[model samples]
Target chain A: MKMFPFVRGNKGNLVGCPVPNAGYSMTINIGCARRSLHGRYFGRGFDSHRLHQFSKGGDDSLTDKVDETISKENPTLDQIRTVKKSMSGAISDSVLKVSKLAIKDGFQVYEAIINLVKDVAMKSARIYMVFKRIEEDGNQIIFSEPSVVDIEKENFDKTVKLFIITKKSTSEIESTISNISEIESVSVEKFTAEGYQTEIPAVASILPPNSPVIKVLLVKIGDQTYAIAISNIERLISLDSQNVKTIEKIEIASVEEEIIPLLDMRDYFGNVKISNARQNAVIVEHESVKCGLVVDDFIKKDEVTVKTLGKIFKNAKEFCGGAILQDDSIALMMDIPYLVEKFSQVLKINVNIGQQHDI
Target chain B: MTFKITHEPFDVLTFKLGEKEYAIDVGITEMILGKCKIFKVPNSPDFLKGIVNLRGEIIPVFDLKSMINLEDRENSCSNVIIVKIDADKTGFLVDEVTEIMSIRSEFTTMKIVSANYIKGAIIKQNRLISFLDLQDLLVGKMSAFELGGKVG
Candidate 1:
């Protein structure tokens, strides 16, 4: 509890008196560092030094000033604090407090950002280490066996496990670690052959390759099975109930309330004959514009693995990729965005509401 | 005219279209699958027989008889050569798969009736078997007939 004396200066600015004998120069320097950090990192217009002086004064008149500055800086500072807490390791209170103050001054974490959400508390915190595999000249080196190395704990009181590695990206390690669960903390320590030690950090959550099971609506078109993302579908309407009108040479379906142009996928694919009359019309929305897809029959919705098409169909934008069905058959994944854009042009359907004057 | 065996014998998959026999490199032929149901595509070129689903892979079927400006004789052609061309798996519809005959590369000459897709001709079993470019016939080039238009 050191007292910092404030003196009123010209232009109503309160200047702090330099107490040389108080041995609080370090604290003043820390305050100055925080001010520079806040200005540089936070991009806020005001400085924290002035706010610190105003807060230390305990004057009722400057209370609004302190509150205003804190209110303005709290969101960004809290975000930084939250990220720091997400990092794998038990961060000391002094480090957290200092980091919070620094963050309030606008310290941004670039290389590593820890998400301090409820699920990522200290007990279940995930630790990640980033390693730089590539050099500037793009020379290659054989990767050490087992890319992920386990870290060891030295101090029993520490919640973080320290890992040592030679080379690998921090992001890659973070993604790999995120697939795992129920970890207290992780500390990645890198020791170069030159005896210099560097600490790289990362945060974790379930990443791609293992996650993101996509749901696609499988449809039977002729003898082919096609899949479209269910998210794109607005509603499934039976063809028997609606009268499809041909407007501007485009087949438009007038559902209960909305008028959507129907795109026959068989026509688009150039199938010679209709094996069966299309039973359902799937209203698809793309880029805020809605259209209908008439299909032979609707198959059950399934969560399948999406496989990208080979180079032959690289120019075929209509097919986004292919999905392997449970029965070991490939179903072409439809690119709704491409189909909507292409058919909309062919049918001369107006994309915007006001532009439908030609219709 | 027959030439000397200047090259080693290589296998060519022979198939019939209309009155002529066509041969394609065996490497390009996946399998000679019998005629399956072909779904006709409206507004597609006349040569396109529609599409066939083999197992789970949907392959676009092209009529070889139509490509060479020949009339479809009847429903006699019952075989489709499922060939891999570049990245696309396409089906080449033909009347019949005659046999796999080994012919020398030298015996196969590009002197057959000049066509964009016809590579040459090989004298196999006393018959002039036209070497057809299956890659060019199927997934290789986009012919005018393959152009899809708005359905009527």
Candidate 2:
């Protein structure tokens, strides 16, 4: 009635027990060993039936003594070892059949342990390889968390997500990841520093504290370059001289089914009329009033820091400020709102004069 | 207050306006630039030359010869003197910056001239150098320009 001893292998691999002299193979149930180890490690109470399985060897006296030792609420290691020693004599045999069976079981257990160790080592090595590959591609693993799950109850699948810090472009990193066959997918997201609650702020807002830069469309008027604030611009249209109609000497152009007054900037800047060159008009809006500012040509758009023209030019209402161009030349920023307002007033005055003449 | 004449050598920057040499206090001068582009402002007075970009700051430049009623001649001068007046900065187009001279207070003689902007005259090395009162010149021109700008 004495139960044979079973050694608990790491990661729930059950080491088979040796056979007794009765020509019967006995096994310590895997569930029993697992339960005992689980109880020992995880502090769970062990049930009497799950603690051990008795062998049918008919040694009642030794069985009663071992049972008496193991029946306590918690059996110590020494008591378990004593039970193992008492059962060893009956379980061991000097015959080749018994020896061969025992050796086969030992080989199976040894193979299971080796396979477990090899599995863990392979996983760690693969993780190291991936980390090295990322570093070689100019990326650093800021953090990594790996998890293993059972796929189809037959294979163990490991997935690792790595947070990488890199200066390389997103396309470059994507290409690098694509070359590695083991990578399933890649996701790129913008990263901000800790305690940064909102998304990235606008570039203008982050510039020098009090002086914010403004985006402007640079246009050529006569020989000078002028910047019109992009916020005030409605659109840019090519000036068609045939479509331009004059009412009471006030030039107007129809755009988007609406007629808007056109102010020739060449005349305003005192440049001689270029009769042969084509002109462009910038449709600008201010206080719900739209006007077309005619210019010689359209230049590029840029972000510029504006500086005020000092007291001497304080009365020059047509210019709000000036910006230093990249070429070290200055481009005056046109006062779009003021210009639109003034154009509307001129139109009103001309219309009034026409009405007076008709009356 | 007592009138005491002491020989304290104060620095003055001399520059040629026309055929004559003029001096202004060196402390008020910010910088001297050579041959930079000046952008003409529309509807401004004739004496108000234009505006110039002085290290990203827009300062208006005035023609010194035209402001003081000198005879109109071919202007080949390219020197500009940036001066700070009160809280504003302005530039003046001059023919040439001669040199920085330290003139004693006693060498300056109070004299009345046709141009009210001349505070006095300084005798240096047997040559007459007019000491310019820049505050009166710039302020007077600014008011006149402002008046004309308002009227136009």
Candidate 3:
């Protein structure tokens, strides 16, 4: 008997074989065989009587020659085996090259796989991802392993299906999977990705959940530790040797040609007299007003997690939030906009004129 | 005259001042902040200890001892009770929060008329607890503004 032929059957039936229609589907498990999942017709047509004759025929070459049945609705067992070999060859020739490049650049095999999937899925409207890894043996012959799937067929339904499982839009996932290398075809149902629990590993452990890492300038006044967002600071100026002039009761620090108003935070911290040594004036721009915050000392810049103050401290305008240091101490995070407004109200000194006379 | 007392129960926070225990309605108490830096506002009243930054709000803190004409003593640990009045908030310096007491209207017996701020006296656990009326406390003082006294 010629191994399963490429003959078209009815809509539901793929093989023109004489078998009970109820038990028609069968899965072929191959350990080292390169197989194409186009199980589309791999399981059809070959009845027990003919299968018995083909195994006993002793024509091993006939088992490997079915390459023409790529789109054949009723493909023979030999054609299915040939499709697997064809897919394995394509994977080794194209997909494996990209995977090797990613691996060489310090990316893990899994990460490379995710990136490849994302790249491929960007092109099509197929939301379901059905993938089979191709393994290359020592003889350089590529073989198909078992189908490795993150998503399944039941997920194709509109409710609690593919879209909801991945927490991604149907169109987005469809396009991504459609773009996968050597992917033949896809079928799906409408769905949603909202509130889906993702499997991707979160980036940093030190940062608070869902909060972005931010750089801040730490300033110490007396016993209090305060952090100002680095983006708000213009520069740090040393006032030890520079001739700091007090104009109109506001200390002035000369930087190039600009004179900025210097206000000591220690005055605001309390009546405690702390030694002002090795202190650098932090120059910050508030609205159009440029002012310097004279402090006791400057700690190195650090990345911190910002948490909002509780309702009890809701009225605290100068402090927008707080960050926990490595030592488990709370460092108050300054609200620059509010601080500037408060300084203008309390100091009675004009902010616009702080830029006038060149120190 | 026998006054009818309402059966509704309310909570009050009791704290120590000198040798006496004072109570404030828990409804008006916003928070109990730990020791913090209190900046002294210039030209303020003597009862106004200073202004402390609770979170970021600058609230005037009043010395409870001096506010009631008692001898001012050094508070080893400065615990501030942030209270809301009308629409504003102010902080009052206290030694520490003693306990929370649930009291009915019938528990309050005598109303002190010497100062309008004193609501009445109530006996809790065999000790006399005086209730301080926050509204009258703010309105009675002409120098309340100097004490960071905000009406609300």
Who wins the TM-score comparison? Answer: 2
Q: Evaluate residue B64 in candidate 2 and report its C-alpha lDDT on the 0 to 100 scale.
A: 90
Which is the winner by lDDT between candidate 2 and candidate 3? 2
Q: For all the predictions, what are the DockQ values?
A: 0.04, 0.15, 0.01
- Ranked by DockQ, top first: 2, 1, 3
lDDT of 2 by residue, A1-359 (tens): 11112222211211111223211123322223332111122111111111112222345655565556546544433333345445532321111121233234331100000011233434433444454455555444322222111111123335444444455665665566545544455555433222211111111111121233679899988788889889889999996688888876678898879998889988877888678445599999988999999998899999877665654554455776677788878888787765785566556434433333332
For residues A1-359, what per-residue lDDT tens digits would candidate 1 score against the true structure? 11112211111111222223322122222113222211222111111111111001223323333234334422222232234233312222222232334435433211222222235433211322211211111211111111111111111222322122213455544454444455433333222222111111111110111213469899877668888888788888877533777754468877887788888776667654464444577889887888888887788899876543433333344665566678766677676765675564434212211132322
Name the TM-score of candidate 1. 0.45
Ranked by DockQ, the better of candidates 1 and 3 is 1
Cα displacement (angstroms), candidate 1, residue B128, comes to: 2.7
- The TM-score each candidate achieves on chain A is 0.38, 0.41, 0.37
Scored by lDDT, model 1 comes in at 0.48
Native-referenced DockQ of model 3: 0.01
Model 2 / residue A132 / CA error / Å: 94
The TM-score values for the models, in the order shown, are 0.45, 0.56, 0.41
Clash statistics: count for each candidate: 16, 0, 20
Q: What do the candidate models score in CA lDDT, each in turn?
A: 0.48, 0.57, 0.47
Model 3 gets an lDDT of: 0.47
